[model samples]
Target: MSQSHTSQFALLTQRRFAPFFWTQFLGAGNDNLFKFAFTVLVTYQVQVAWLPPAVAGLAIGALFILPFLLFSATSGQLADKYDKARLIRFVKSLEIAIMAVAGIGFVTQQVAVLLLCVFLMGLHSTLFGPVKYAYLPQHLSERELTGGNGMVEMGTFVAILLGNVAGGLLIAMPGVGAQYVAWACFGLAVLGRVTAQRVPVSPATDPALQINWNPLSETLRNLRLARESVAVFRSILGISWMWFFGAVFLSQFPSFAKEVLHGNEQVASLLLVVFSVGIGIGSLLCETLSRRHVEIGLVPVGALGMSVFAIDLYFASRGLPQPAVSYTLGSFVAQPGHVRVLLDLLLLSLSAGLYSVPMYALIQMRAQASHRARIIAANNILNALFMIASAVLAGALLQAGFSVPQVFLVTGLLNALVGFYIFMLVPEYLLRFVALLVSRCIYRFKVHGDEHIPSHGAAVIAANHVSFVDAILLMAASPRPIVFIMDHRIFKIPVLGWLFKLARAIPIAPQKEDPATYERAFQEAQRVLREGDLLGIFPEGAITRDGTLQEFKGGLMKILQAQPAPVVPVALQNLWGSYFSRVEQGTAMVRPFRRGVFSRVGVVAGPAMPAETVSLDGLRERVGRLLAA
Candidate 1:
């Protein structure tokens, strides 16, 4: 309810978020702790005929993710049909039971029982995954969604890192390592259950919905529901691709540190620490970079960084001299070349954090509340599939005699291709990227009273246009998409025109000049408002030839009469003499660097006026006041 909280860390102090954060944090820590300890036990100390040491880690991982592929659909349905808080408590209770059995397996050294417990733990996670994502939207405002998700993501990775460290340390003790690990797992599970009991009540999104028990049918249905929103579905695919890209690096860390970097187990652990810390830092940075909104522009930036660093890592890993002795963590860090390798790994993961958090937040913001959990379930299914494919592909590459660094190169190149394909499919990402560049780089853009723009429903933004890039700047300031009504002539310009077309800006001409185009533009604008989307119009009819206010036109009045939506007055400041404006002899963009780069410019929005009360003069007066402010 405290949407005004500016810092993401503030959520950690609140009842609405704190208990749930700890509950999930402990669950993730416990999951990693038990699994890693069991892995070490089997791979190092105890050996089994059925599960060879070479394949023990792989087999355990496969079993753990198997439930996501099998039961995610049902779990999503349950999350939608029941109170998430109660479901979380129930899942934590199940963790306690599973950990109890795992304790017995550890004490008795029963490999089969431990493996069975692994599958059950996987089931527990599958059930909790939907509840975890669905609960946030219910409790947090849209302003807090990105920050909330970032905290959770950062916490999840940190917990995993700490859990793995604890597991590895506890499992290496003299004779009681397994017993210690058992007790630690049981304690963490109990703590998780206790925390879950304190989580605030989160009611079901679709309490009246019928339950779907069949996984295959329910999965197909969930996918269909996700496909209802192209943005949300593509976001799911984007997130899955990220997992695929990451799994390649994560699954190869041991081999990479040993074979490529010629380092010992400590060096591998050091790589994990760097990666986990980098991702945590990037996740926490999203709230600040996005200004507490779901800004998908960062996705392209992240994708680009991911590929660049991944490719660099390939080159960094090559041509190292073989050392007589395996390098320890300290010795590895002492080498300058190894530092580049670590830096590449760190930056790649940081980019991944940026890439993923927004898509998750976008899915939460855009998906229908009724089936949001089901869509997240679909995402989980896809993520599982992609990770599996990543493993298979990496195996195939290595089997064909590709070195670890070569595998990294191939994955990075694939990431670039995949990123290009996704961005082309969704031009909104590209539009936002351009908008971000224009606002952050071309000018030192600032926004005021942006919160006055409605977060949802239909509205019209009536602003006094000053430059060709006003729409792009407005796009950067807004949290939602706006369909701008622009001059038809402007659509003939080169790069900006293509971007405007991609943004689906409705091109209008004067009624006397082109009556049909004018009518069609107005019709499209009306339809956009009727469909509860934002519509942006210049309202002054054309950009001013001189650096002064132009008389407002009646187009806004016509739009209000037809759609009856509130109109928000906006003003563009300090851009009249800029490069894109008609500054020199009524010609625009003829002079380069007219205002120089990063020149001061601003967009200020006034409070919305009721549709019935709005008039041409009143709106113009409001925008004039905003411009002068």
Candidate 2:
């Protein structure tokens, strides 16, 4: 709720965020602690005919996810209908009760009861999932969404790592291991409840909504609600795909360490440590890379890196030297090829963190506010299904005599294909990717007065266009999407034209030259404004043939007369001589590398002028001042 913090770490000091952060951190840690300790207990100490050591982990995982399939739809509705803080406190209280029962099971070594506790804990997480995601949007501003999600994601992985370590150590005690595990789980549950109490009240988004008790119908309805926004629905699928990709690596780590790397259990733990740390680092970096906005450009970048590193991991481990004996953590690190293996895993997981955090932030930012929680619930259900499918696919691969490395290879290739498919379906991701590349690599692009761009509602951006890539750079500068009105001639260029088409940029010609195109462009611009979307226009009407300001045209004035909206004046500076600009004999792209790589360029926006008072000369003067500045 606090907007004063600039860095994500500053969030840890605030009451609004700190309490929720710790509550969820402790809950995640406890979940892993209880499950891992129980897993070790069954695999090493207790024996049951129904649950064999080889399948104990699988059985626990299945039971845990089963609740999500059955209850996520109901939990989503409850989250929407009740205050999230109240729901959080209630969930924490339920955790305490579940742990109390788990304590008894741990002490008595009742495998069935402990297994039942796993299902209960899964239920606990299911109830909390929708609330956890929906609560962030309620409290944090759009600028804070990415940072908040990053902190929560980083904290979660760290907690899971610590929980697994503590659980293994406590449950391996020479005597009374089970009792120690029981006490630890109970204490964590209590701590979580205490933290939950301090969380600031978060009001329900849809308090008056009636409850839908039936899971099957409600699940379908929730998904339909999510699909109302194509971008949001696809983002949910992207997040689910990330879970599927991650589930493969996580589930294979132990076996990969033992069979591929010839390492002991401690080595497997070391791999977990490396992967978790990588994810935490990457999660925290999102806020910095995105410049405090929800930037989805990083999604494609993340996907590319995930595939690259996963494929490299396969090659890195394909022909590893078989150890004469099992390797301990120390000796494993001492090996020649082991570093590459660990590095591959680390980078792969880091890419995963980058891939997922933006999708989560995007979903929060774009989903309909009233149905946000249900949408998140739909996401949970899909994530559960994907993880389950990952397990089945991985199991089948292994059964078909594929090595772990070969499985990684297949998954890596599959990731590339899936990413391509998703990007084609949602060109926004690819569009952002191009914007990110052009801004960060082709030029050292910077923005000033970016806050002047309205975060919501329809607004028009009036700027002096300098280069063919001006729209792309502007796309990088603004956090939200902008529909641009461009000269139709620019649409004839090969790659740039395709990109503009993908961005849905409306192209126009002079009324005398093409009356229909000119009229249609204005109609589309008005429709965009009516839909509360940002419309961008080059008020100069065309790129300046010389590296100087051109007189502002009346097209922007025409649009404003038709659809009243505030106009933000923007100037693109130091871009006239760049490769994309018309600097070489008054023709753009005639000569390459005119300014070399990383050419200094800037986009400056001034405060919005009310639509009623805006004029062509006044707007031109405003842009001129910004260009000089």
Candidate 3:
């Protein structure tokens, strides 16, 4: 729980996480597998009196989504009110019973009964949704939150890929047919129940709270809880938007492959497989990319990449040879510029992982534990709504005579707008833009002792400011967001000043120069710490003219004594010669481009010490040792 394990995969070998993870994985797979098999049956084989196949597809989609709208509020409350492990077992048991009924429907081939199965499966998923996500924060350490969520998401997409493949293959089998699909669902349900049984005890978050059985009122209550925190609410919106975007892209894959790429079924399958693989790989890399922290900085970067690749995909698909013969998967890849199109799809999916994992982690980390499940349920409701809107919009556009590629072009452009609006709404997303730009593009950055940075709670980062960009490097490398306390002159500088404002950096002046400004800066810094946000300051007061550590100022001690927060010692290494630094030893005039591109730099964090024990000498010594290390 301390995040002692460095690798996310290491969690798979731990008892606390392993069973719950597999239970969810198998359960997700079964849901998709059964749904795909049934949909295919409804589309091609069944001769139903109720509706046509196209209409049936819409009906089934509506039926599945209806349960989330109706039942999610109740399920979210139940998760908070009961032992989660036991609740999971109950859900799996229900799954088995539903599968048993589904088996009967399969044999009878009753369209109404199969539709009932679809609705039942949706109900099961709705109940499980909150429990699955809310369970992780209870088990994983905060440092593990991002990695853990990433693993779950990667596993989920992998399950989806396998489930879709297995569904089609099993349903089309000669003798087994629907029976094989039914048996598989039942077996998976049983296995899920077995795994659920092995899950560690997860006590109710709020057992004493009374249940609200009224769906409509309870649903509104959950939505209110989700909106309680603007950050969490915005994060939920980001997630819902992702679902909308994904739904639009995936809903068109079949038609996109056949009509646009002029490819057969195998080619469609190939596109899906590539997309899934890319997402899975990207999800796994999130932990490393984020430096084992819940780095939402990747979210804006992901949104940017997603839109860019989607637009490129439109270009990659344009003016292609329309052959008389349908292309096989191999032939599709072999076509001129087709591989580029595949790359776009893969990158688009990869960026989807980047966009989503952090947002999920952010919600989990920030939401109140007592109402976390209900908040997730609220998110589910919105996701369903957005997805439904996507379907309707896509249908309307296609009806209005837009090509699939053209629709993608429109979707991509709309994504850019949506992503920009969200970033404007939440400055955290914009801050991530700064972190990503500096860390990924400007510098080859590395961090050591990142685990020493506390995952939560108030702390002051006392670092030696070796250069103007020292704060930038520290901001990028720190596990948590840091509010740098800097000189007002530095805070007033051009483009850098704008970034400082976005980062919420507190600006100070010397008491003699401006007492009001100095006092205000201290008040702001204390406020940040009291609010449990990280406060970063250069105890050296300004960037060093020489690379050697300067005598620490007394202001840091005064601030720490007043606030009583933990002090984390940070040292920026190998940045003295950068353009932002006074590298010539005594000159104010600075070169604009001396460090060149992709300069190697490092940040090292020492263990956090009590604020009571913080001193100018002690912090300077600690940071000096770290810099020398």
Question: For each candidate, what is the lDDT?
Answer: 0.92, 0.93, 0.88
Model 1 clash count equals 0
Candidate 3 — what's its lDDT?
A: 0.88
lDDT per residue, candidate 1, 1-629, as tens digits? 11344599999999999999999999999999999999999999999999999999999999999999999999999999999999999999999999999999998999999999999999999999999999999999877899999999999999999999999999999899999999999999999999999999898889998987899999999999999888899999999999999899989999998898999999999989998998898898888887777888889988998999999999988888789999988888899888888899999999999999999999998998989999999999999999999999999999999999999999999999999999999899989889888888888878888888887899998888888998998998888789999999999999999999999999999999999999999899999999999999998888888978899888888888888999999988999888999988899988779877779998888899999999988888899999899
Candidate 1 error regions (>4 Å): 1-5
| Model 2 weakest 10-residue run by lDDT | 1-10
Error of 1 at 214 (Å): 0.6
Name the regions of candidate 2 deviating beyond 4 angstroms. 1-5
lDDT tens per residue, model 2, 1-629? 11344698988899989999999999999999999999999999999999999999999999999999999999999999999999999999999999999999999999999989999999999999999999998888888899999999999999999999999999999788999999999999999999999999998889999999999999999999999888899999999999999999999999998998999999999989999998998899899888788999999999999999999999999778887999998999999889999899899989998999999999999988898999999999999999999999999999999999999999999999999999999999999999989988888878888888887899998888889999998998887899999999889999999999999999999999999999999999999999999999998888999888899888888888999999999989999888888876788887678777788899999999999999998988999999999
Quote the lDDT for 246 in model 1: 88
Error of 2 at 305 (Å): 0.7
Off by over 4 Å in 3: 1-6, 585-597
- In the predicted model 2, the residue pairs found to clash are none
What's the TM-score of every candidate structure?
Answer: 0.98, 0.98, 0.95
Candidate 2 TM-score to native: 0.98
The digit string of per-residue lDDT tens for model 3 on 268-309 reads 899889889988978988998887778889998889889999
Error of 2 at 238 (Å): 0.6
